[model samples]
Target chain A: MDMRRLVGGNFARLRQAKGLTQEDVEARSGFSQQYISGLERGQRNPTIITLYELAQALGVSHVELITPQNDET
Target chain B: MDMRRLVGGNFARLRQAKGLTQEDVEARSGFSQQYISGLERGQRNPTIITLYELAQALGVSHVELITPQNDET
Candidate 1:
């Protein structure tokens, strides 16, 4: 299912939906902007704790970061 | 929310609920039994890909590994 791409797309979707930039997530999550950028591009595999922190910073549940939307359906 | 503890507990609970041992998860997940034990014990921070693999090996959604159960309610 290409979970990496799914997660990246979902993360990007959610962040944009919230009107946030990667820098905002970096500031709130204590992760570097490059790291966040990598995650969104599916170029990095983040730890569960990182995902949790990013979710918190994005004002969303961690589950939302991995669940794909209906676009595939 | 002590997210580390929460995720570990959730992972352990879900694995136990499925009646699978750490060894069983290791065999199915291709992750080391020691690593699985550490994760269950809240001593290891697993990557998202690792979480996904664990969930797949456990026959559950990745979200299940991070969601807190109702016992906390």
Candidate 2:
């Protein structure tokens, strides 16, 4: 429900779906792998710019990464 | 392209669409009006919980607030 958790969950899901590793995202995003790990665990409170970078690296829009989907709807 | 800017722009847009004010959001989300102002100005880096609360108050998914819209798509 929280943005951090939502972002983390979505990030993991999308990354896995894309068959990407943390290293891959890090390389693409110019962020540290450790940062990616923390982000996935919802341990980091990212800035807007960071979110944009992550979204771009993941090939998803920032909205898709932050919004929670209603599976039923 | 920053998350702060994205969230602020989306928040302002949605709030205006709903005819809600920062005070209304503050009353609904239990946050301060000043904080809302800061948030809407991209001056705040909110926590996940804060984002969730804001989303609920605004009757939107967190994703909608954070993601950038592709006007073409």
Cα lDDT of model 1 by residue, B31-72, tens digit: 888987888788888778877787788888877777767774
Cα deviation in Å at residue B16, candidate 2?
2.6
Alpha-carbon deviation at A21 in model 1, angstroms: 2.6
Worst 10 residues of 2 chain B by lDDT: B64-73
DockQ of 1: 0.66
Task: Compose the digit string of candidate 2's lDDT tens values, residues A1-73.
Answer: 4567667878888999999999998887788899889888988777666676788999987667776667512
Clashes of 1: 0
Can you tell me which runs of candidate 2 are displaced by over 4 Å? A69-73, B69-73
lDDT of 1 at A22: 90
Clashing pairs in 2: A48-B3, A48-B4, A62-B67, A63-B67, A66-B63, A67-B63
Task: Please list the C-alpha lDDT of all candidates, in the order they appear.
Answer: 0.79, 0.78
**TM-score result, candidate 2:** 0.76
